[model samples]
Target: MTSPADLIINWDVARSTASRLVPPGPSLSPAAAAREVADVRQAAAEAVGYVHTITGLSAAEGLGEDQRDVLVVDRPGWSAANTESFRKLLRPALDAVAEKKPQLVSEGSSAQVFGSAAAGAELGGILAFLSANVLGQFDPFHSSEHAPGGRLMLVAPNIVEIAKQLNVDRSDFRLWVCLHEQTHRVQFAAAPWLRDHLMSSISTLSSSTLGRADGLPQRIVEAVKSLRQEMGQQKVSDQHDAAAGVPARNRLLEVLQTPEDREIMSHLTAVMSLLEGHANVVMDAVDDSIVPTVKTIRRRFEQRGKNRSPLEKIVRKLLQLDVKAAQYRDGQKFVGHIVETIGMERFNTIWDSPEHLPSEEELHNPDTWIERMGYTPKG
Candidate 1:
């Protein structure tokens, strides 16, 4: 076991071998960068050091190996221009969910939620391309926090470009994704079973220390380039043979989820779907009040189809979890129906306790959503 003192923060572990995730802010001359640093200091003092600063989005290679804990990055390149579009896609959902759980924004008497749970400082950063190195896979992240356990990692999602790909305007979509990551932080803080379930599942698959390796095999690189070439000419089909890609990883996930893990994963996925779904519902409800200029910016990626990463395609091929376009539709429909059946206020009240959320059985049936609430909705 690598001791805390010996755990080396290797730059190779960063998403790209060439660099580290940079902090926000434009490229600066030494003098200009100095002034920006001062501003960062001022912001840090106001918060509990929850947020960190970065120079570029790619400086992940530069992180201190010894550094650990939840880091909320206050980026330098932040722009209303960049974020505004997503607000449109996400406003309806955010507004509705907010209406559902008003106290979440308030109710300070209870504990606060962590911004994210990550294996490293980088888990939540915005990624033009996602990778296990950056967003630590749930199947592998684990530890014994009980004994100086670094088992739990808190991370925040910095998904600036996600809505652009989805082909939806940003307003609501960005906020909702943020909320989903935020949901993890919330789940970790509020649901003890959640942390256990996630960590246990991760540990069962691999170990506490699945650090990044040096590089991919040369053959795999050649293979991937070859595949991309062939793919341009051929429509993907079952016979298209993705297994030909190099560095092929085992998709079955060796560690099977225990009944406890399954229960937790199902609920967590459902809660995430609900959280995101509710955000969409909220957006649709109060969309009349949504700002105008924000609507002008179209970040449209919603209907573009499933995230088409090689890893995603591989998983779908292996597990047949097609992740329908309507996957989220059910959640949206479920929440909307609930709000229509019971008044929004009553619909919102269920979030007061975890028990009020639906079970897997309910998640399966859009029509049975209200029935799962153990009562028919009041027309």
Candidate 2:
């Protein structure tokens, strides 16, 4: 572990702060909660086999049993685990900074202590906001003393709450959520190298972005202030801008990214688009014969997003979740187009190597990718 004196973010502080700030999930009796946990775990296990059948990607080939473990956790557990992953993922960048500027991380330095606390609170707040929204996640960077490699997490309370809000069949919804997350697990398990590739890309981007640490404190403060103002503003809605009541640019992206950072971000977003879209495709690929209520689940899910409270909508926009929502839509279209064009077997070739992955432009223009891959369109 990096010494406290040399760290930029105090992860312990982040975890505790998130725990304090995250709202309690829907109330459940002890027995009901216990049953929900069992049902979720079973659904996750069931999903693994279905994902393999639909996507033809298998984790059994390379992943260890522990790596394949599925966990059911509440919002707090999700926040704490993700904070630890964030720390690990960003460690390389932090280490480089510490090595280059020893004085900035000097032991017991008041500036360092305050900066770490502020950064922790900032990150913790973000996580707290997100905890309520995420249903499930397949974390590739997951590792621990007890388990190493990838793990799938189901936010039990989030799942229960969303299902109730959608008024969908609880059993069907649990499997539906797991299907999406399991596809992610299969994707990484099938391509073990992908984890390293992503880790390297993130580390490089982080190092480049955080290299200066100039006015780091002021930047953090302004960002938190801006975010609070945006989240707290009652007027912001999906149909209206936060301040001007006009279509607005994603200010969060603009503030955080330089040109070089944007380039990296573009690549990362394209990759995420592919992954998320592919998972979505798998979700719908399974016929109603399997999930029974798949169509209703999707319809209600989309409607729920459209009907979110104004505050929820604004928070999502500020956090760039609106961008993620676009990723799922655009990505699914791209995947659907490719599959229909070349068939799923041929489309599977996209997973053969990093070079085969579509660029952001290619995601919008599928034929370009087909042409680049040396495929001719059929009548």
Superposed on all Cα atoms, the candidates' RMSDs to the truth, in angstroms, are: 17.3, 5.5
In candidate 2 the C-alpha lDDT for residue 369 amounts to 92
Q: Residue 107: error of model 1 in Å? A: 45
Let me know the TM-score candidate 1 reaches against the reference structure.
0.41
lDDT tens digits by residue: candidate 2, 1-379: 5663336788888999999999999999999999999999888878777877776655533332233368899999999989988888888888887777776687678978888888889989999999998999988898765445577889999999999988999999999998899788888766777888889889888887777567567766776677557757756666445574334355554455677877777788888999999999999898788899999999999988888899998888788798898899889999999988887777787877889888888988988999999986656
**Which residue runs of candidate 2 sit more than 4 Å off their true CA positions?**
4-6, 60-68, 144-147, 213-259
- Collision count for each candidate, in order: 60, 0
Q: What is the lDDT of residue 236 in candidate 1?
A: 51
TM-score of each: 0.41, 0.86
Best candidate, TM-score-wise? 2
Which has the greatest lDDT?
A: 2
